[model samples]
Target: MSNTGFRVYLNINRPDPSLVQRFGGIAVASIADSMNRASCISGKIKPLNGAPLLGVAITVKTRPGDSLVMQKAMNLAQPGDVIVVDAQGATDNANAGELMVTWMQYRKLAGLIVDGAVRDVAAIRNMTFPVYAAGITPRGPYKDGPGEVNVPVSCGGVTVKPGDIIVGDQDGVVIINPDDAEDILGKIKDVLVRETKLRAEMPWNGSWVDEVLKEKGCEYID
Candidate 1:
């Protein structure tokens, strides 16, 4: 028998609102290296709105092509929570659309990141609501589903649990597990500074590689 009901967790520990905002303030690429480069959601998840987004994750794991639990997720979300949906990476049909987006906006949720497709792009963009999705289609999602909310779910190949921080921008989206967000956030600014300094020191002419080649005594066409 197929499981068609929904499961939800009402209580999840999320980061402090101020802390999430601070993490969001930094560029997604800024903390890329610090996270060991493994936490980024796929590049396919592009920003639907032309701005950055940051919030705690309200994870939803639903059957492919279904969004029943996603609807329930909205009820559980707090202001500034990012709805992170795991739809098994389905690409043919949208997992959510305009109505859901509108409701979420009214609730003052931070943003959305779906590891699947989404419809009603025009309305979503018009609202300036940040949304990242795997793809777009006119096809909508089915509500009848077997799913779970506020649980650990895989979004764009990354395991995201409720309360984890979600940061997305034009570059891409990444999941900062609640366990590591604070520690990583503490050093991200310093990492950014060092990165900026290192970048500033690099030569645009591409001669930096010559030192290593010379060290190895490699003879090659310059």
Candidate 2:
């Protein structure tokens, strides 16, 4: 790798389209539950809209206020790739805005997820593109160098690597290591089934709560 700010790796191992398809319909919350609730992205990063996010991760690690590396990553991204940026959770400067996001959408990218601030909220809200960020600022970003692409990076308290599956929705985003995709998919299916069962019983009283309270040695007070 060069010492330059534009450190990028090409030919990342993207997950199979079929596998990615399996995750697209699953809710981000259900995926997190299947992962034992350990890989949920921090609440600070939220979706810009209700559009669903499901694609292979193109991990980017950049300076808090720089987008040069991010721009490079965007160029390297494929039609269905999700550019996941780790900007150290900086909200003082906007790392991306309307122009940048518009280009991504034009390229048919899956989505953009930034662990830093982004700008142009008004225009972004008007589009169907899925964008998630920790904060928003009009300060804009510097195009200076010093970032890496397609490497392991942390975003919103979770570690993400190139080729990881990124799933997001109204709830939030979750990263799935491709190595565990099959197993996680199986668990997610089970979680969905259980949720369906529980939903069907909503009209009935929740007697299970009483069992739990008694097991914890709770005494009746009245």
Error of 2 at 116 (Å): 0.5
The digit string of per-residue lDDT tens for model 1 on 1-222 reads: 533347788899977777777775678887776787879988877888876788888989888778888988888898989999888888798998999998998999988899899999988887778999998999888889889888788888888888888888788987887677777877787788888888998766757689888999999976
Where's the lowest-lDDT run of ten residues in candidate 2? 1-10
- True lDDT of residue 148, candidate 2: 92
Clashing pairs in 2: 5-146
* Candidate 1: stretches off by over 4 Å: 1-5, 202-208, 211-222
Task: List, residue by residue over 1-222, the lDDT tens digit for candidate 2.
Answer: 466555788879887889888887888888889989988899999998878898999999999989998998899999999999999999999999999999999999999999999999999988899999999999999998689999899999999999998999988999998889999989988999999998988886979899999999999989
lDDT of 2 at 78: 94
Which residue pairs in candidate 1 have backbone atoms (N, alpha carbon, C) closer than 3 angstroms, thus clashing?
A: none
Best by lDDT: 2
